[model samples]
Target: MKIQRRTVNSSTDQVLDSDPVIDRIYKGRNAQSKDEFDYALAQLLPYHLLKGIDACCSWLYDAFKAQDRICIIGDYDVDGATSTTVMLKGLAGLGFTDVCYMIPNRIKDGYGLTPALVDRAISMQAQRIITVDNGIVSYQGVDYANANGVSVLITDHHMAAEKLPEAVVVNPNQLDCTFPSKTLAGVGVAYYVLIAFRAYLRDQGHDLRFNLLELIDIVALGTVADCVPLDKNNRLLVHHGLKRMRSGQVSHGIAALLSIAKRNPKLLASDDLGFAVAPRLNAAGRLDDMSIGVQCLMSDSAQEAHSYAQTLDSINLTRREIQANMLDEAQKSLETVDVKNEKIAIVYGEKWHEGIIGLVASMLKETHNIPAIAMANDSDNTILKGSCRSIPGLNIRDVLVDFDLQHPGVLIKFGGHAMAAGLSLNASRLTDFTEGMRALIQEKVTDDMLQKCILVDGPLPQSHRNLPFARLLLTKGPWGQCFEKPVFDDVFTLESVRKVGQAHLKLSVRDSEQQYDAIWFFCPESWFAVRAKQVRLIYALSINDFNGKRSVQLMVQHAQVVESLPIVS
Candidate 1:
């Protein structure tokens, strides 16, 4: 692994509001001024700038005025769940009482708006169908709805296809659209649609008193959970959402989820949304029906929210167990192939759980520092479903696209973002698919791109290596994806090293002028077998709590022995 620090300009004196170190970190992340970091709703771009939004708003207004039955076609992930909930809540507040939602089962309907989903909506006598989080690429489903006298409004954020459906599409990624932030999560797009619709209603002399800002909690959760880039617009959404949650002014569902996850709403952070809440909500979609998850998110009664949250929590535990077993099985299967020499890994099993293959793929990608695909038998034993995960430089979806183009008729279907993708293929074509994918990845991934890189915000000065600095950094962020928590790399002399509860390593280390406690979670036993006194470490500053006391601690990310270091026992 390589360690490097980001560069920042020295002319940021007038723009920063705090410690010079924090200012440097912010500038290194491309923050032009302190205003860019502000979470005020006024910082968001006007909804009018979003292409197709005005048209969507007008269409929805006309439909609602006529009391048209509406159905929201949602995907099954966290983004889809929150998008559906936000749209449903916002629509209800806008006097659309007949609105309903339907999310496809992951194992049954696959992804996006299928013709079957349209049929279900039609059966419900829906006059208008709006797709949230999915439908930008759902040409056939959109056409099906249009043919059946139903208007389809697509509010998606995924990359669009060339031949788009003949519906009003509000995706920022569309070719002609110039929406400033293309990284809006599905929920963000839905919220913008409501904002535009509210404006249109006001023009029509309808006096509606809907507080759309209250829906920011779900918007924030979905945005962070989806792993989207934390651009200015997204950051603003999360910031307000966190504020609402911390102040106990959030929805019953959010409060319930926080309780089940053992996270105090008063101390909520973006990290909790990703690590605690999202997994439980996503587990329902991964293991069963996302409708249940949506029910929890859409709940208004505290009692009902708690009941649904407990059920989801139980499912998330099952998800973890299944993932762990599948990972173990996958590692055992790797013995058949030379994983060390392979540019990419494609592992499969006859009965591997399809729901957990994506998690397995992610684990393999991070452990091996290579692109990986984990495949399992589909419901039809003749076809195999595969989940793929890629490294930074390799766009897994594009690679799959090129592979499909090169070898037609092999891939059943595939679509996802740059780092992850999903597909199915005939069971017999597994060999061909693996070989073809490996060739394509080898052609694109350069040597430098293949190597793992650990980035740092330079070394922390002794003066700033205290609990106060750690606490200050925590307040400045709901960080994830593009906006990451600050980490630093420095040389330290090891004073002690010992194994903790499971696989973690506890250490006491000293730098030039300070001694600090540190911990490395999930450390391999072999890493401590040949311990060295002087080590180069990449770590993040953290406030460690023990016995009702808090102190500065370092959570080590990577560690290596320094050259010419003598073992001092």
Candidate 2:
């Protein structure tokens, strides 16, 4: 494994902050100017810049004027749920009375706007179907909807195909979309549609007082949960969303979920939404019905929201159990298989829960530092559904796209971001598909792409490793995905070490007699090699509060044994 230090970009230091540490961080992260650092909403790009937005808004305006039944077809994920809720609230607030939403079942209905989902929407009397976070790839489904006399509007943010569905598509990543930031999550696109639609309504002399910022928390949650890159526009959305959440102006559902997750809304951060709140909401979609999650997100009252949050939390616990069992089984199987010659890890279980396979794939990717895919039987047991996670430099989605092009009929359906994707095939073709994937991956694989490496922001100065700096680090950026929080590396002598929880390691480390508590959550196997010696630690600064007192803590990222220095007494 390689440990590399980040180099600051000099050109980005024009609008440097007062603190040198902050300036270093800003420059290192390529922050160019004051506007970028401030994250001002005014700095966000105009919604009009998005291609097809005008036509998209035209469809919504038509639906509004005609009083058509509008049913939102949403994907069964956090982004989809938030987008659906945002649309429901935004359209209803804009005086569209007959708006409703339906999230596809992860297990039974499959992903995106399936013909089955469209039929269900038509049954709901939908004259216009607006798809949120999906529908970009639903050619057959859109045809079915159109054939049924249902007009469809697609608002998605996934990588687009050369040919689009026969519907108005508003995706930043689409071929002709000149929108500057192509990294908007599905919810981000939905939010933008609402923005444009509201503007269109106001231009038509409707004095709608709906503030789009009211849904920023949901937008932030979806953006972070989807793990999209935090480009300028997305950062503007997320920064303000965190600001609103921290100020107690968040939605009842978000607040309730945070409360149930034991996260303080007053101190809400991006990770809180990503790891805590989003997972609980997603659990409902993964294990049960996404309608539960969508209802929770759109609940009218605190009591109702809390009830749903509790239920989702219970589902999340069950999901964790299922995930742990599946991961354990996969790990045990991999122990016997030599992965040295393999460029990708593909594992399958006949009885594995399809909903939990994505999480299992993510774990395997991190552990093996290679692309991983976990497959399970579809509800009918005749097809296999797989979720993929990839390492850096390997665009898994593109690989799937190219593979499907090269070997037609191997992949049933596939779509997603570069780092992650989903695909399915006939259960009978598992062996053929596996070989195709490995061969295709080998054609594109490089030794550098397969190498395990960790990047950090060099060393944290001994003088700057105090509580105040730690708190400052914690509050700096609501960081996730592409805009990662700074991780610093340094060598420290071990003072004490102990195992905590089930899989966590709690320890104390010293730098010249100054001791600090640290925790390695989901500690790797390498810790067992360096736990008793002086070690080079890669960690993010964190604050641990106990009984109203806060102290600096090291949230370990990686640790390796190093020779001891004689600087300490």
Candidate 3:
């Protein structure tokens, strides 16, 4: 991709701290440093509120003392798989052999703890069951386990409902949770629980030789993959994880994944995990079976991991093709309606796959800049399975709750966080539900929230477009939701623009002082309407490593030519 370069004033003046609004928004919290680790640990919430950690550790300690059966109930997603692997490896290090793990098939068991899964655990004669990445809302499943005389410990990061399950719950979002960082991903929370468990074991005179921190690699993978905000504690977890991964201490499965994605282990970044590795891990859960993913993580042999990675890679390709076809059909359906006039956009099709509804909803939100919901007819029972993606100002779950109150007995079940949600409803009620959602959104949404603006960080100088600077940005990041990767604005004189890859813009740009290359992916041709003389650009700095040679490149996000007005002097 060719990136256009522009020259701007090289002003190094720092903004004064007296600006309160800017300070609050731009510099909310300074990035964490290594020196803050000890202080962070000291300030962490008490061990008891962490939920399943203490209980699970205590049970494991007793099991070690008495030699009883232990099994881990693992979820199928990236977070679930990584957390399970970490627990299994950590327990094995502590000389536990009776420990085993079970990952439910996405198609067969759906999500979280279920009665069927509980029966499977019972069949293994498991004395204690520890759940990873799920089970906070599994009230019935937890009750079933308890009735069967199996102790259950739940460790999850999803939003909790009004009432929680009876199992020892260790979620940061719990009603009475006092954890400073409420944004910890499931794996990060699981890692913290493990730390607490190790501490308890050490206090009891157990010989746990391996440092618990080594598991940060798995924690980082899950945290990034789950799209958790990179807050203070999460940054530390990911930072340590990236360090270990770069040092070649990560698991063989992760190494194989990186290899398949053509990513260098030593040059791993959070983006690599999110865009490259995470999707492959998620593909198993999305299309085929999550057991493939969990097994890949649990694999000790490099050959076995590589084989699973290949299977995941193939599945991911198929997923992308399916997603593209669904998105195209959804966009066509959207074009026939005036979504801009409505507060919320709801669309459905019998052809849309239930497995990819969430992704389609996300794409619709991006395309229309509104909270969008997409539903698909489930072939099994003719039920409407839908997913919603909301904008920053909209609380999708609350919206659904309002809709539920308006039309009682319409929605079968729904639950999710502020930005996204999922639900099941009768196929016959689709039109009424869609109209209700649109009406509710119209009442709540404002005009200013409709226009989509690309937020850019500080402006960039032409001098900063070099390999060293690109490397600096890459290495200095564990960037995610809150702490976004930097995007710089520059005024470039477009020398020429050409089409590439069907819908991409390949541009050659130059300023008064220098010239640069850039590319804008999937941007429309209408972008050229801006006068080329004073075109403005917003882009992220990246390093292009090809054939063992590295150079700087810009990935354009948005561009607009400046509109000149009549001079009034």
The lDDT values for all models are 0.88, 0.87, 0.78
TM-score of each: 0.94, 0.94, 0.89
Q: What TM-score would candidate 3 get against the native?
A: 0.89
lDDT order of candidates, top first: 1, 2, 3
Clash count for each candidate, listed in order shown: 0, 0, 7
The candidate with the higher lDDT, 1 or 3, is 1
For model 1, the stretches where C-alpha displacement exceeds 4 angstroms are 10-14, 493-495, 509-517, 528-534, 545-548, 562-569
Ranking by TM-score: 2, 1, 3
Q: Cα miss at 178, model 3 (Å)? A: 2.2
**lDDT by residue (tens digit), candidate 2, 1-569:** 88888778787537577767777776777777766666777787999999999999888888888999999989888998999999898888889899878988888787788888888888888899999999888999999999999999999988788999999999999997889999999999999998888888889998887799999999999999988988778888998999899888989999899989878776666888888989998898899998998899899999999999999999999999999999999998788776647778899999999999999999999988889999999878899999999999999989998889888997888877778898999998999898899898888878898888877888888888988886566566868876788889999898777777767888899998599999999896545434356877899887776767778889997887686435444
Local error of candidate 2 at residue 511 (angstroms): 2.6
Residue pairs in steric clash, candidate 2? none
